[model samples]
Target: MSEASSSLAYRLRSLRRLETFACLAAVIVLLLLPFVLPDFYVYFAALVLVTGLFATSLNLVLGYGGMYQFHHAVFYGAGAYAFALMLTKAHAPLWLACLCAPLVSAVLGFLIGAICVRLSKLYFGMLQLSLGSLVWAIVYRWYSFTGGDNGINEIPLPNAISSTTGAYYLTAVVVVVCLFLMYRIVNSPFGKIFQAIRDNPQRSEAIGVNIRLHQLKGEVIAAFFAGIAGVLYVVVEGTVVPDMLFWTVSLEVMVMCLLGGWYTFLGPLLGAAVIVGLRTFTGAYTEHWSLILGIILMALILWLPEGVLGLIVKPANSKMELSAETGRK
Candidate 1:
């Protein structure tokens, strides 16, 4: 190989090592955070991680699978309600509710995907948003069962994990496990098929790929994870509300991924951390936190279209691309 090629390979290897080190350092800090920080910030830390997982779930479809989903929070809402209902009405064990919450959302995803998977672009987004909004409205008004607009309050958690610190640890465990599974999924052959369909639908279909089935499956996977995020939220917060089911919830999760650089696997997680951190700190001081966040996001989007993390990774990627182009020439 040429000297330039050798240097490029060394640089890429060094970058990957740095990336891995950073990830490990983050995990360690999070593991030790509850012990170090005050009680309030511990809860705030849990919220950031939960929201990060939620954003990662949405990115699985929108960024990786090329789906246009507008009301992804419907499944998230379903998960929260399922967990809340199981606790309050069914008197189910915590483990059982945890297992079932995501399943309920997966079922919801299947039903919605069956209708929306065949459509594309604007129509798919519109149909999903409409159907999801309808469900949200029903939940909001179903006072007989759902507690209506006021929402279910002071919901109980399994006694062993009731404390905020304990709940944060539990959230950490679930989020880490789910993130590992997602990492495997996105890099697997099945995930590659999603990419195939997204990149060349006609060719993929010609080669016997069932586009709709893959798309629907993607929906189920994303929904299941999003549901897990909802479960974490309710478990940590000890409340379930109608607002959790709203379209705005979906927008928040989606925006995090977009802001963090949707193309990269870890971007949504970073994006979630940044957004939630800002909200927590900013809201502590001023009521106009949303405006501040909006302005900051606007600037990030204009300057670093890929994401904040994208800025860090861009140099390595650009150098690789340049090397490849030089070889081609």
Candidate 2:
């Protein structure tokens, strides 16, 4: 290899090592956060972790699979409500309730995806929004069953994770595991095929890729993980509300993916942290937190189109792309 080629290879290796090191450091810090942070901040940190997982799950379909999951929070709310209802109404065992929650979300994903995947782009998104709004409406008005708009409160949790610190640890572990699984899914052959379909559905269909089936599977997978996030939120907050299924929640998650750089794997997680931070701090100071957030997001969208994490990784990615082009020549 030429000296230049060797240098490019070295830089690529360095970037990989740096990424691995940064991930490890982040894990260490997350594990230590509960112990080090004040009580309130610890609780706040837990919210970040849960929201991160939720946003990341949305990113799996929205960013990687190239699907617009406009009503993603429907699955989230479904999971939360399922778990809460199983515990409170059905009197189910803790283990069973926890196990069934995500499954419920996955089933909803399948039913909804089977229909939504029939359309492309804008139509698909619109159909999903319509269906998701239906679910939210039911939950909002079903006073006898779902407690109506008032929502279910004081949800029963296990003794082990009832404490804030314990709950934080549980959230941390679950989020890490779910993220690892999602990362593997995106890098797997199935993920590559989905991306191919995303880039060129006609070409993928000509190649016998079964685009709709793959899209459906992607929806189910994303919904399942999103359900897991809902379960975590319920565990942490001990309540389930109709707002969890609202259109605004879905929009917020979409924004998280955009702010974090949905195309990049960790972008949504970072976006979640940035969003939570902004909401918390801005709300503390001003009554118009949403206005402040809108301005900040607009600025970021204009200036850093690739997202905050995308900006950080852009140089490395550009170098890698250059190396590939040179080798092709």
Candidate 3:
């Protein structure tokens, strides 16, 4: 192999090592944080995890699949409503509620994806947005089933666990598992095809790939994960409301994906943490937290267009090396 190829391989190996160490260190720190931090902080961390998962799920489509889906909140809200209704109305177990949340969201995704897969780019996104808004309106106006504007309150925690600490641990475990699964999916052949579809659906289709089928699969996967996040969110908040299903929430998830650098696997997670951290810290001192967040987001967009992970994982400077090696040969 050429010197440039060798150097690139070496750099990739080093990056993989660094990532492994970072993951290990993060796990260690998270495990110890609950012991030293206050209960409120633990709860805050749980919220971050839940929100991060939700954002990352959206990234699965927006980042990898190159589909700007504006209806992600529909699945998230559906999961939240499913969990609440199951727990309160059906008196279901927490585990069962969690399982059903993603299933319902997957069903919704399948139906939506089936219809939207035929369209490309903006049209698909607009259609999903319209469908999502329709669902949100139904939930908001259906007073008999959804509890309407007041929402469903006093949602009981899982009977198997009583303490907030237990709840935090449960959420942390679930979030970690979900993230790991996402990581695997993104690194798999299926994920590669999704990226291919994102980069050029027409070219991929020309190469005998079933573009619509692949995109639909990705949509369903993303929705399933978002559903899981929704369940965790309601569990953490101990309540469910129509606002959680709004268009703004979908925008927020998209913002997190963009802020984190859509190309990087861990970008959405870091972005979510940053957003949640900023909100928690700023909200404590100022009522104008929204203004502050807007300014920060603007700065990030202008200065760090690639997101935080992009800053860390610099593109390999191999072009020059390749030219040098070719000259030597």
Q: Cα lDDT of all candidates, in order? A: 0.88, 0.91, 0.86
Candidate 1 TM-score versus the reference: 0.90
Higher lDDT: candidate 2 or 3?
Answer: 2
Per-residue lDDT over 245-266 for candidate 1, one digit per residue giving the tens place of the 0 to 100 score = 7998788877788888887788
Give the TM-scores of the predictions, in the order they appear.
0.90, 0.94, 0.91
Give the CA lDDT, 0 to 100, for residue 278 in model 1: 84
lDDT tens digits by residue: candidate 3, 63-87: 9999979879999989989989998
Lowest summed lDDT over 10 consecutive residues: which window, candidate 2? Answer: 1-10
- Higher-ranked by lDDT: 1 or 2: 2
Sorted on TM-score, best first, the list reads 2, 3, 1
List the lowest-lDDT window of 10 residues for candidate 3.
Answer: 314-323
Total clashes, candidate 3?
A: 0
